[model samples]
Target chain A: MNNFLTHIGRYILLMRLVFKQPEKKSIYFRQILIEIEHLGLDSVGIVVFISIFMGAVLAIQMAFNLDTPLVPLYTIGYATRQSVVLEFSPTIISLILAGKVGSRISSEIGTMRVTEQIDALEIMGINPATYLIFPKIIAALFFNPILIMISIIVANMGGWLAGSLTGMVPSGEFIYGLKAFFEGYDVFYSLVKSVVFAFLIVSISGYHGYYTRGGALEVGEASTKGVVNSSIAIIIFNLILTNLLLA
Target chain B: MIEAIEISKSFGDNKVLDNVSVKFEAGRCNLVIGQSGSGKTVLMKCLVGLFEIDEGRGIFGEKVLSRMSFDEMKLVRQEIGMLFQGGALFDSMNVEQNVMFPLSMFTEQSIGERLERANFCLSRVNLENVNKLLPSELSGGMKKRVAIARAIAMNPRYLFCDEPNSGLDPHTANVIDNLIKEITEEYGITTVINTHDMNSVIEIGDRVSFIHEGKLWWQGDRDTILMSDNKELNNFVFATKLTRKIKGL
Candidate 1:
């Protein structure tokens, strides 16, 4: 418990350093663009591929269970839309990112720490935390919402395709259900969750990486811990945000 | 000059540096020599503020390090340059970008101006035609040269090197030693080097401080070091049979 609290304290201190005013805004902007390419843009393909399969599976399963006479044919589409928009696209997809982007951030920073590159930055009078981490946080915050939007669009199209091909539900009914009772606030809640998740993933992973000690073995350990911890945080916050925003 | 005044550091119960102090003068190569785990590297880290000293303080010219606020310390750090044992070049950036990093971050120079300055530093280190290569692609000697180029990019007043020749062949090591010496003299920078290599001491150590256990055991010039009567210093300075034979001791 003491060790955990110490880590918490250190993490808070690190965040304070990370958010300090950048030495040069132009350089920071360039770094943010680079991070967007590495962390956000590169992950698009995987996010799209995974979302399609998940949406198809959700639609099929909903159709399979809604076979009773009392349930409407459109209920399958409704359930798939709610699951994808409210939870699957935002929460499950973010968990996937916690594994992908989180590990990358941890290992990159951990390697920098071991190599003394971070120390070099400090010796050069540059704020190492602000220079190394702030750009990543900004890039993720800007691009993650767009990625989530893409995931939503592709996943719904996938559901539509699965319904037409599998004959699980009529295409007209699925489209009608998708358009029916559409609350814009659900999208807002999802975007909110994605932004929060983006911050958690980048900051938590960066914390693990920045404080990495020892060499190769320790860097690997930091990466693993980064992914696991960020995933857990995403799950916990998913529940909290759901309660706070929707309930 | 940069000075450490009775600085002490400990990790848990293991005291690494105990009230150690030394002064490094400008336009000279100040070498800190010791056996492995003798706290020489720790002392260097303390001087650079990488590791906070438990007692005493670092004095850079007229300024007291411990008395400075974070911004003041940062300003002091701008005048300092460091070369790590492994070169510590940014893995993702090419040589040119690595060398220009400080200028881009600290100065309002245009990219063209930064490039010209980076070119001059690289040329000063006698490194050319490798600007597009990554650190991993260069030979060990070349990497160290590139690191030197980057260190001098800011025209710093103080230069610190930790194990600058640790993994090089003797020939390459000698080349690096000469380069550091020339740069220190050319820039009139106070250069502090942490090294265990006796060759470095003989070739470039204008002033040598020997640490034993956790104490500052001895201090002298390179020539005086060979003739010192200190038992621990003698054991360290003439550890090899070849050195003993050369000294006819």
Candidate 2:
């Protein structure tokens, strides 16, 4: 309990430092662009691939479960839409990113720490935290929701294709059901969740990385911890926000 | 000049530096030497504000470093430059970009101006036409030179080098040592170097401090090192058999 509280306190302190005023706007802006490319553009393929498969699998399972005549054929589309918008797109994709993007941030910072690059920055009178982590967090905030939005669109298309091609449900019914109960608030909720999850993923991973000590073995450990901790934080926040917003 | 006045540092239960004080004068290479684990690096880190000193203060000119707030420290640090043991060049940036980094952060100079300064510093370090190469592509000696170029980019009043010649061949190490001495003299910067290499002490150390077991053990110029009666200093200075034979001990 003591250790946990200390980590939480330290994380909050680090966040404060990360968001402090930067020394140079031009340098910070360049860093933000670089981070956006790494965190957002680079992860597009994997997010798309995973979203499509997740949507397909969910649709197939719903079709299998609701086979009886009591259930309408269009219900598969409704179920897939709800699953993608309410949970899968934001939560699962962020969890995936906790493994992908989170680990990279941790390892990169951890390597910098061990190699004394961070100390070099400090000795140069630069706030290393503000210079390194702030841009990454801002980039994640700007880009993660966009990624989630893309994931939602592609996942729905995947569901439509799977239902129509497999003959599990008529294409017309699937499309109709997708449009039948479309609540704009669900999309809004997803965006909200995505932003929060993005903060958790980037900040938690960055905290782990920034505090890393020792050599290569310790850097590897920090990376693992970054992924695991961010993934756990994403799940916890997902549950809390879901309860508060949609209970 | 940089002055450390009774600075002490510890990590948790282990004390690494104990009430150590030393003055590093300008226009000379002030070398701090010790065996491994003797707290040489810790003292340097404390002086650089990378680690908080447990007690006492470091004075850079008239400013007391330990008493300064974050912003004040940043202002003081603008006049400071450091070269790390491993060069610590930004792995993602090319040599030109790495050298220009300090300028970009601290100066309002145009990109052309920054580029010119970067090129000049690189040339001063005897490296030419390799600005496009990444740090990973450079040899160990080249990396050190690039790091030195980057350190002096802002024309700092004070410079610190932590084991600047570690992991280099003796010839390369001598080259780096002489380069440090030349840069210090040319710029008239107060340069403090942390090193265990005796060759560095002999070559460029105008003034030397020896720390042993977290304590300041001796202070003198390199020429007086062989004549010192300090047992710990002798044990360290003449540890090698060749040096012991030369000292007739």
Candidate 3:
């Protein structure tokens, strides 16, 4: 318990340093754009691919379970929409990113730490945390939700296509079900969760990387730990936000 | 000048540096020579604020580095430049970008001005037309030169190089040594290097401090080192068969 608390405290302190004012606003702005390209643009393909499959699988399963004629076909659409919006797009997709983007951030920073690049920055009078980690967090914060929005849209399209192809539900009925009980608040909740998950993923991974010690073996260990920890944090935060906002 | 007074550091129960005091004067190649694990690197790290000293202080000019807050240290660090052992060039950036990084972070100079300064520093290091090349493409000696170019980009008052010639051939090492000496004399910068290479000690060591087992064992210039009577220093300086042959041992 004490070790856990100490880690939490250290993480908070590191966040403080990460948010400190940058030495050069112009350089920081450029870094943010680069990070966005790395974290958001590069990962879109995988997110879209996984989300589409997830939506198709969920729609098929919903259709299979609601095979009775007593159940309305539109209910499949409603269930798919709810599942994608509430959990799959934001939570599961982010959990996937906890392995992809999170591990990359951790390994990148860990390599820099072991190679003395962070120390080089410090010796040059630049704050390593602010210079290296802040832009990543900011980029993730702005881009993860955008990715989730894309995922939600694409996943719905996938479900619609699967419904049509599988003959699980009529196209008209699926469209009606999607539009029948739309809640604007669900989108808001998703965006909130995505933003929180983005923060956790980047910050936690970056912390693990920045404080890495020893050589190549240790860097590898930090990367593994980074992915594991960020995934766990994303799940925990997802539950907390769900309870707070949608319970 | 950069001065360390009674600087001591330890990692948990293991002491790495103990009451080691030294002064590195400007316009000289100050070398800290020691065996591996002798804490020369730790001492240098302490002087540069990379590691905190457990006792005493490091003074850079009129500023007391040990007591300065992180914000306050930035002011002093701005006047500092360092060449890391592996060069530590940002692998993602090309040579020009790596050299111009410090300027971009600290100076309000226009892009054109920063590029021009970077070009000049690159030329000063005898590297030309390789600005767009990545560090992975450069030779080890070239990487060191580029690191030196980056280190001096700010025209730092104090320059620190940790194992600058660690993994270089004798010819390349001598070239690096001469380059450091020429730069120190030309720019009148206080340059401190941590090295275990005897060749570096003999070639460019204007003021050398030898550390043994976390203690300052001996101090002198290159000429005096050849005749020093300290037992540990003699053992270190004459450890090689080639040196013992020259000494008629």
lDDT of 2 by residue, A40-121 (tens): 9999999999999898888889999999999998999999999999999999999999999999999999999999999889
List, residue by residue over A22-88, the lDDT tens digit for candidate 3.
Answer: 9989899999999999999999999999989888888999999999989899999999999999999
In candidate 3, which residue ranges exceed 4 Å CA deviation?
B245-249
Model 1 segments more than 4 A misplaced: B245-249
Query: Per-residue CA lDDT of candidate 1, range B157-249, in tens?
Result: 999999999999999999999999999999899999999999999999999999999899999998899889898998899999998788776
What would the TM-scores of all predictions be?
0.99, 0.99, 0.99
The per-model lDDT (C-alpha) reads 0.94, 0.94, 0.94
* lDDT (tens digit, per residue) of candidate 2 on B1-249: 999999889999999999999999999999999999999999998998889999999999988999999889898888988999999999999999999999999999999999999999999999999999999999999999999999999999999999999999999999999999999999899999999999999899899999999999999998999799899999999998998888877
Chain A TM-score of each candidate structure, as shown: 0.99, 0.99, 0.98
lDDT at position A23, candidate 3: 94
User: Model 3's chain B TM-score?
Assistant: 0.97
lDDT for B45 in candidate 2 is 89
Docking quality (DockQ) of candidate 2: 0.88
